[model samples]
Target: MTDHIDGALALSWMNTFTEDFHAAQQALTDLDRQAGDGDFGTNIASALRKVVAELPTADDATFASVFTATANGFLATGGTSGPLFGMWFRAVSRSTATEGTDTDLLAQGVAAGLAKVQTLGGASVGDNTMIDALAPASQALLDASTGGLTVDKALTSAARAARAGAASTADLLAARGRASYVGDLALGVEDPGAVTVAIFFEAGAAALSA
Candidate 1:
């Protein structure tokens, strides 16, 4: 019943994102085949399933607990992306407190998460990684938080930014992770990581609006 980006909303977003991921799992699998080991969809889906199982009920969950569950779940999964996502979520969990209903705190957690992803992956925007989608989405959330907008508006902006960022990755050369092994051959295909990030932001937006 959460209407914003609180711990409850995070759980709602995960459910929505997982459903969306399942719908696009085949496409994700195909995209990964071009640049990675063809297991990105499977890995992310598996991680989400574990996260859902580990997390407490929405009413019982705290912001920190939500992210902590996500981090642990992603870490338990197999693949290079798993550890990178684990680091991002862990940083977010560490940044979060037990409180809820503060846009600034959510923004801070996302900023912290982005920083961890950058540091761990040694990636920046346009790196043909999840960072590409995450960076712009975080910036959008920050802007919305600074502007004193509603969480739904902020998440909508973030989702849009993520989509645009992911689309842009279609032309980027892989600069990190397993995708980097493919070099320029990754051209003309969106990075699967970025696409998944976009879906997550989209789910967040939908959850907050609901």
Candidate 2:
């Protein structure tokens, strides 16, 4: 009955996300090649590498600190998605500007992050952007929190929803982002940003489960 994710757990989540992204980097780049400039995976890998280098120790870590480091890492990276993700994590940092966060609070942070991403990126759920995964994941977190699920279950639910949303992007004609530039040529290709969002939630779930 872990009721909250403390600084240590939050740090672990970021590390896991970094590892997961590294493993998926080649695949993500290939996916992006179908609809974008094909540098998506390399760019994100660069950002995560910076994030890992800047990660605070568990003893010094707080939700705000961890998220802020992540935000800064992404912000320093080049490209549209990188900066958008930076702002998204920045909002999450603001929401969880404390030592720890319960599932309900985490949900609020994720929802706030989603809102910031949407505002900054000007993309919506069906736009075949990262919002495709982020929007559903945000809603899933809110639902899980309201339903009184444990932290692990709540994160798992969000991860599931995010994966589904990312998968859906494969069938979509991109309405925004780099994929949009390719028009129907991206019909069978999943947006790399959306898949990355799913990976983020999945890493969160795995981090808490461990």
Candidate 3:
């Protein structure tokens, strides 16, 4: 069994994970220029910067505290990524408030995030959006939990699912976001949102493992 993650650890993890999001944003922006708008990197970086600024002080922090701070920050500073990321963090915050952070808690948090994204974005599995990565990663974590897998094992599963989901986008036609405007040209390229979601999952998994 893994130890519970407290407010301090969670805050540290989020700050560290921000770097991964930045890298993923750059990668996605590079990909996007070939098939869609090229501003995803700048947008995600800007939102993450706000998220870092809005993180709660360690003394008063709870999962909800951190998430709500992130949500408010993103909503203020980010465009589409703001609302979407804010919704994800808000949902996860709601789910994790009572549970703290454990393998099961993490899974629940991811599930909450996925539900928010689906509801807010109206994106399904094949939509070539963040849902492509998040839905599968959430389900994989859930399945691992159902099988009584350890936190480490479940996180590994989710990471694999996220990566596979991101890769799968290579063949998908975009159905939402700016990429959708490109039609068939969007095929053979990964969705920036999906790639970024995968990066987030991977970062979370790594942080938990640490």
TM-score of each: 0.92, 0.96, 0.89
Clashes of 1: 0
Sort by lDDT, top down from the best: 2, 1, 3
Model 2, span 1-210: residue lDDT tens: 567888898899999999899999999999999999999998999898888888899889988889999999999999888898998888777766355788788899889888888887788878889999999999998998889998789999999999999999999888787788889899989889999999999999999989
Question: Whole-model Cα lDDT per candidate?
Answer: 0.84, 0.89, 0.77
Candidate 3 stretches with Cα past 4 Å from truth are 97-99
After the best TM-score superposition of candidate 3, give how far the Cα of residue 110 lies from its true spot, in angstroms: 2.3
Using TM-score as the measure, name the better of candidate 1 and candidate 3: 1
Candidate 1 versus the native: TM-score?
0.92
For residues 32-92, what per-residue lDDT tens digits would candidate 3 score against the true structure? 7966778777877888888778888889777677767777766676557668877887776
* lDDT (Cα, tens digit) per residue for candidate 1, span 1-210: 332456777778778887998999999999999988899999988998898899979778776777789899999998888888888888767655555545666678788889888887899997889989999999998998889877778888889999999999999998887888988888998999999999988988887777
Clashing residue pairs for model 3:
none
Which candidate achieves the best TM-score against the true structure?
2
